[model samples]
Target: MRVGIAILSYKRCDITRHTIEQVQRHTKADHELIVVDDGSPDNTQNMLEELGVAYIRGPNCGVVWNKNRAIYYLHEMRHCDVVILLEEDTFPMEDGWEQAWIDGAKRWGHVNLAPSHWPLNDRIGGTGTVSNPIISRYVTGQCCSFSREALSVVGYLDTRFRGYGHAHVEHTTRFLRAGWGGYIKSGRDHNFYLIRSPLKVTCLDKPPPVADYSKNGDVFNSIRHDHIHRWCWRDEEEMAVFHTSFSTLSRSGIPVPTISKRQWFLSDNTDQNLVWDPETQVVISTPDKKDERPRVIATVSGETVQFKVLRDQTFWMTWEQPGEALLKEKRSEAATFKLIYGKNGGVGFFYNGLFLCTDHNFNDHIVLSRPEMKNWEVFHFSGFSDLEQPNNNPMRSDRIQDWPL
Candidate 1:
């Protein structure tokens, strides 16, 4: 496949030159390099002429506009099979990097290959597939690859997105909705490096003036508003811990939620019976409630479980149980019974310690009663699977061996 590399450069001549050198050294496929100079004051055009690389120059338009212009030139003027976009700061690490994207495009027809450094921990910020491409509705434009078909269908980046913003995300969503497949290939480890410079100097030289999002609020607002499912910590303390955990997992590109003990809870009356050992990555919760009656009224094994906590408090567990028929009648009548792990390692209903085989299936609900606990708080856990053996798997627990990392 014919691959074209388009690097969007502003005033950073040194970084742009380095990126070009790296691409030439690592890429094995036949490719043409095009650098779009967005009216840079620096000697960028002169350097590109010296390096013998094709160039496109335009008036001082915004970054997104410059990017769209370059893409249009590559697609309409050059007629390349695939276009790989990179910023001056990003360099490729792997040999045959172009081939990886070409191969991916052959399989998925339209794929997005991004550099490894793109943050994936945030649901909205990772490499994704077309089936559920975006955990949240956002995509990074820093470094990405696109097949010719995708470019034709999605067109160029929306010019309304002026400075650095949601232009790429909006484009990706449009492509996915049109029945095209997208995949994120982990770019070479050392192939691409984000040029880290002093923010003060960089910002002063070319400060990103905030755009009036309200003016083009319709497009920007739709993307921002659709991202409500993206997870957020309730407070500052939780956010700090999340950041640290996220940083560690980011190295391998495996996306997971940043979980914390603060977000977990046990019965209020218990003597801190919930044990969490970070060193071991295990959590053990031993019941301390004396009433011991089942709090769940009904449970649908793979769907939902409705149970009472305090008289006014109710808890819902989304999962399926095995023996549901026995409890079907009791569930309809609002019978009180606790669901617990049975001796046979299956779901069992319990009332006062004797495993009660009630007509209603009460196998998966764990009942607890704490009169002092007034307000109910939602505890967030990652790696929850309704199809898995234990539906409510703890995030930081060794017991959850089959949990996806």
Candidate 2:
């Protein structure tokens, strides 16, 4: 098989260089290497040049877009029998990794080389000294191998998953539906190592550039608006059995107004005034020192919930008590969040049960690091009303600019 390796790279020059160096050092088989740069304005181009590797520079098209481009380049452009996709953060851990994946690809059309929990089956042992390949229901694209024939069957990776979520599952589901089996090759010494993702910095000197909150939100809502139904399984209404609605919003004879405006909401009912300042908008600035930080408090049902609207377009919920005290206290106290609905009655702030609670001190907030909203993450002011007419821009004259960041 004519094997090709395509690395989807952005920012993080150091990590990208390390990943390339590792791939070059470990792989013993003869295969072509391609690096697709997603318009990262860094030393990425120069670094790839210094390393003497094949690369293509693309616009800031996002994760899935670049991934599809990589697949296209390797499978269609290069006419390879199989293409391997790797992110700058993940790289092979052992020699002959390419050969192992190529072998696995022959058995199963798709092979995930990264170490992740088996989607459907438990980890199985290989031989007395080797690990066996385990079948997976869904596999991420991080370090996965796909054959040209499999791509022909399942089609290319959907570039519509433009940002950092669900592309793996969506693509994997397609392969599964086409009767293509996905597998995990074990018995190799840790096949891959996922290094820390580049630190987000606003400065130009930083390796990877960080997009501002609004731009990030635009990308996020774009993906969520398009593919959320598939991600949340909205077609299967029977799965939403976890929680009940708030009595006030449900029973209030307000026609359960649909999310009409895109304004941010605070839980406090007493503060009717708009919280945002037009002159110097909320820039998501953080105090240099924790001790120097001013106290942030919001009242919900007469009790104070320590909350902060971060610059990244996500809110944080925290508690002042210690770990043990935090455990003993009712989940209602810290977790009890008031509805921060938009003017259109759409939920501006909510949590996804899947990616729940990123820990910053004792705070738990939705990880807005990515663009797609998890199934539990979305809610409507009028019970899925916002979702029904997602693109609708219902105007509310009374609404004011409240999203500070």
Candidate 3:
């Protein structure tokens, strides 16, 4: 399917840069990206141009209007079969994630690509080949894919709505009202994992102009707001956590076989035997083998929440905890960790699978600033997958000669 990505960006250049670069980097299918800049006073246009991004600078119309303009640009102007709508703040976690939503849009009508596990799946269940179903009543537009057929029926988002409150919801309601079905691909899936950008980072030097939330709320209430969406999932708040394996985050996309049912001791002198369950992604402190279950000391995602092991010796991963907390707990005071592969070929301890920098020295301790094939980050996998950058030699003989697991 011919997919098009439409980003409605006002400011926040750093976030927008990541959004665009990552999307362009991972997308393998035929697609185009059009960033609609809603006339930001900041150097948004210049920044996008410098990055070789194609953007349209529209008038300082509110968020809703800018979104409508983007839909028109993608669906009507470009004649794309599907348009993937992304807000500047919504970030994707997996590579080639758009392919799933694109496939979903062909089967379902409107696909909410970024829905967290809020409304239950059974609320609007499926009739397609894939298991993930479409929500018939409610949908959000953020990080969503609209089929050309779906847009032809629902039309553009209502330009009457002033700001950023319920344009997504109102547009969704119109689709359902028009006898079309809406689906939400929740972030809980491994392949479709997406998360909101961390709020702590100061991306922009100055605060750019943004619509007032209270005013947006006032506008939403002032209009036709009593749309009945059959409520199935009624969670108060939705938490987003990264779902892909650590190795996948690397620029090279190293394939690490999921470790399971093995007792692995840390390379350090500490007698810490890490027994990791690949399916559960959990580790317990040396199973007591007593009547009482072993407490879950840590998880592959790095959550340190202490809970009793279930009958299957697994614990439920809670979304309430942040993934960053888990990574930090795993790091601890040790600057490095060597995840040794047991009796599994030449697989050894690998560095954290984040982007690597070419200019800097090889330091396994820090997550690098950007993507490059400069550093040698290795870990052991039992079987073999094709190396993404086999020709780019980052491994130094001097550094890895003493490969002790």
* TM-score of every candidate relative to the true structure: 0.45, 0.44, 0.45
What local lDDT does model 2 show for residue 224?
A: 36
- For each of the candidates, give the backbone clash count: 19, 10, 5
Query: What Cα-based lDDT does every candidate model obtain?
Result: 0.45, 0.45, 0.45
lDDT of 3 at 195: 24
What is the lDDT, from 0 to 100, of the residue 170 in candidate 1? 58
Task: Enumerate residue pairs that collide in model 2.
Answer: 126-131, 126-132, 131-187, 259-344, 259-345, 259-346, 260-344, 261-343, 261-344, 352-377
Off by over 4 Å in 2: 114-132, 183-405
Q: Model 1, stretches more than 4 Å misplaced?
A: 113-119, 122-137, 181-219, 222-405
